[model samples]
Target: MSVLLSACGDDGGKGNATNTPTTNNNNTTDDETSSGGSEGNTSTGGPGGTTTNPTSTTTPGDPTETTEGESTTDGSFITPPDGGGGAKECDQWTQDCPEGQKCMPYSGDGDNAWESLKCTPVMENAGQVGDPCTVEGSGVSGIDNCDKGNMCWDVTEGVGTCVALCVGSPDAPDCAQPMTSCLISNDGVLTLCLPSCDPLLQDCPGNNLCIPNPQNPDAFLCVLDASGEEGQEFDACEYINACDKGFTCANPEIAAECDPMAIGCCIAFCDMTEAGVCTGQNAECLAWYEMGQAPPGFENVGVCGIPQ
Candidate 1:
């Protein structure tokens, strides 16, 4: 015999009651990539084993794998042979460069590494002095260099800025400038320069996601969910808890479930539309306690049985 108590009842007092999670509520801001890694202004992946559109890189988060349509975070690219690394031409693939020119591997040899690589050169207006680069290889923090025609320029300037290249520089008008709105390939890496830290900054490349800041809308904190992979769903109780005090997530769905730990956990609501109070959807229901429900013998509720 088990008894079930619903948290919806008087159990929710004024003071001690847990606050609902606060969702990001800031208006969309301009796009901005982080400086390095996921925190940096870019999302990365390893070789996918196949050829991809050079001009376009990856949509933030989604990486490439061995199969087409598959993604990986290995940071590998599938570039043509003559471009360097031969068949693995895309070893250093970036959004910069002409359509077919992207996916070229790093060519310059020296301690200069990513900064001196010919495939993607340090732009004239990097904003930051000296070379802006991370690791110089495919396994760790570096990216692949596309063909000579294309170049994924660094807009952020720092070591880990979102790099976007222009195909046939003379042809594309936006590519000529340092900071400008440009088209990113649906299947390649995407980067942007956001004005603020709003969650909208996560949408720069279009495929990445952002976690809301309970403290302030101005702070768009970066989440490391699936930077170089597909979007994955997680259990509600797994992470998010209630949002900060004083503020509650307007959407009960998110507040009810979002885990405090996991990156992407949404709230689930009970579907009172029918009979049983256990009708919540998504992962939010994991922590729900129905109201106005009575237990039979500390075993089960009058109507709503134990949550499945």
Candidate 2:
């Protein structure tokens, strides 16, 4: 099945500037037969809803590579908790662990690397729905927030909540909450149970807004709206739309020079012709590119950044 989520647009420029909103194509296979494996296809469109395909001139690199000039810090790295009050870190690739424990990587987020890899005791008693969880940090893999069957999903900034894994279908849902619905990720690889909300009614819990689910247009998730306390440049954000006006949530994996955190932080978009418009005293207006996915008009996008 194919699900499409509308990508947030870059609206920093004035009139006559191109407004490029992206489309996330969630391509999925039959849930019953194949393992859940999906990829994201981003389509770029210009103003007046005109679509344009840019020529591919450069081969995309591995998604895990840090951007140029960006340095990764090993701080906040999590080690395996020793039941006897000792700390031991395990290497996931080498499978170095005690006889009963296994070296595992975090699967809730899309990150598959071993930034915060750990050895976890094999247990069947994972956390249930509504349980608090730790958000996975960048380059870190392996999570102990949930039991073997459940997934720890980032519902909001710094808030990873326990959720069930299931094949997304309207006829039968795996969520325990009556109002919760199964939502697929942008890449269509993982299906997670998220609380349901209605945009028309505007009745979402917290300060969240009923935003359209990019994976499934027929569904919506309660996401934080860019209002009071919106993310500024260098502030962490859950989604691009969560940033204040004139800013875009830039992935640290793409920024390379910034600290590698779990969530992308806000960065100011800028006009290339304007001089000294960026907020930072040493920031520069550099071309911005979305990692892996190519949205239209973003081929020449620019954002303010500190010089490396």
- Taken over the whole model, the C-alpha lDDT of each candidate is 0.21, 0.34
Determine the backbone clash count of candidate 2.
11
> For model 1, how does the per-residue alpha-carbon lDDT over 60-121 read when each residue is reduced to its tens digit?
12111110111122121111011111122232224344443333323123211111122344
What's the C-alpha lDDT at position 234 in model 2?
64
List where candidate 1 sits over 4 angstroms from the true fold: 1-71, 74-135, 139-203, 213-217, 221-264, 267-308
TM-score for each model = 0.24, 0.37
- When summed lDDT is taken over every stretch of 10 residues in candidate 1, the lowest stretch is 1-10
Supply the global lDDT for candidate 2: 0.34
Candidate 2: tens digits of C-alpha lDDT, residues 156-184: 23345665654324234355557665543
Worst 10 residues of 2 by lDDT: 61-70
Q: What is the lDDT of candidate 1?
A: 0.21
* CA error at residue 261 for candidate 1, angstroms: 9.8
